[model samples]
Target: MSKAVRAVALVLGALWTAPNTVIGLLGGVAGLACGAQVHWRPRDLALVFDRWPWGPGGAITFGNVILHTGDALDVVCSTYAQRAAPCADPDIVLADHERAHVFQYMALGPLFLPLYLLCGGVSVRNRFERAADRYAMTGRGWWPWP
Candidate 1:
């Protein structure tokens, strides 16, 4: 993509996904009140809040924001296995999985949630989650659409 094209795409994607991003920001701001810390993940094109005060220990993505219950994004955050991940020592980054969801949100906008629920709403059978898992592992093919 040319520079101008990429810039336009970025603006359009941000606008297209803004509603969901607003919802994420609400949670992120709440997390802030509860002592969570936020960071920018340029690689994921998202803002991540670490040590969020709710839910089981892991992470969740809403548009371009990721709320994680852990101290960092450098370790495996999924309940599933990632033994072959690219971390230097033990564990691996789970940002890729959530980032996949962010991209999904950008592509589908407000339609992503209903479609996700229809696809099984976060489980082994959910094509969205599966595609995300595949992308996090192999680093490609994050798009769930045929």
Candidate 2:
């Protein structure tokens, strides 16, 4: 897509997910006071905070904001991914998985959270998480299975 078109799409996506984004921003604000570092990735159209020191030792994405427990976004989330096997894809990264969530929240808006919980919360059995991993591994399939 052209830059202008992509920019407009990004604005609309961010707006669509604004409510959750606000919550994520609030968490980030709190994390900042606790020594979390934040950065904006223009390519992903997302904000990422690292060393947030919360959750299950990986990362969680709310809308386009990602809070990662680690100091970087490229590591395998073995402690929290809840998968049956270790990731074998050398090119796959945790940031890609979180970015898939950015799209999921953009698509589902506020309903995403409740539905995510209903779908099994943080388990790898969760379709949302499975889809995110799919995207991370294959660079496609971010939508939860029907």
Candidate 3:
């Protein structure tokens, strides 16, 4: 996609997921206050919004917390701390997986949140997550499976 198109998409995507992004920003600030370093990758904004809510194994059960159980994004808020550089081999695979979820949010728009909750379970097992996994593992050519 062209730069302009991509920019528009990002803006729209951010807007579509604003609630989650805001929560993420707040969580990110808290994480920073708690000594977690911030990381950002230019290729995709996911890393930019990513934040390790608390140290490993630490849980803070609040709004949308479940959405960030793993390397997740409830529209925003990632629960891991790492470099902001371009993803490498294995990391790229993982990033692809998460990227698929981004597309899911884009497609579902406002309905993504409720549907995700309704789906339940982790991404590996959830229906929506499985679709994302398939998209990542395969491609978008065969989406909205029958």
Candidate 4:
């Protein structure tokens, strides 16, 4: 597997307890390049989640997805990697996958999550995953997947 592929797999493995929406690794600097607007370290993510009453993860103002679990990636859910994962224009797989979520949010507008939960999320999530994979394959040398 490529670096991007491995990273994605590693991130997905860490994030999914229910297989709802796994957005992949949070590459800090890289994530910023990719449009992630937060300035967070791995420890900060852990602290927030560990200390928070609601749970480990929650959505940030700019659409960043913060997973509270240890080593959990902080992602920008708006742009690529939801503007969370670090990559100034990620590898093909990463960008494509992340962008798919962006598109979904665009299509659903404000009602994305609520509708997603009500719609048996598996289908939409699967569709987005497939979108990333497909987009990655066709993206040429855009993202090395590493």
Q: lDDT rank, highest first?
A: 2, 1, 3, 4
Per-residue lDDT of 1-146 in model 3, one digit per residue for the tens? Answer: 99999889777865777666556567766766655555554433553323454545322221222213234332322222213234331222444446566666655666776877876745334576556545555556213344
Q: Model 4 off-target regions past 4 Å?
A: 1-92, 122-125, 139-146
Tell me the TM-score of each prediction against the true structure.
0.87, 0.87, 0.59, 0.30
In model 2, residue pairs whose N, Cα or C atoms come closer than 3 Å (at least 3 residues apart or on different chains), thus clashing, are none
Residue runs of model 2 more than 4 Å from their true location after superposition: 78-82, 85-91
Q: Write the per-residue lDDT of candidate 2 for residues 1-80, one digit (tens) a residue.
A: 99999779878888989999999899998999999999997655679999997886888888889888899887764422
* Candidate 3, position 16, lDDT: 78
Which candidate's lDDT is highest?
Answer: 2
lDDT of model 3, residue 115: 72
Model 3 alpha-carbon miss at residue 22, Å: 1.0
lDDT of 1 by residue, 1-146 (tens): 89999878877887888899898899999999999999999888899999999997788888888999999876865423333345333333588788888888888888888899999886766889878877787778789875
Considering summed lDDT, which 10 consecutive residues are worst modelled in model 2? 76-85
Q: Of models 2 and 3, which has the larger lDDT?
A: 2
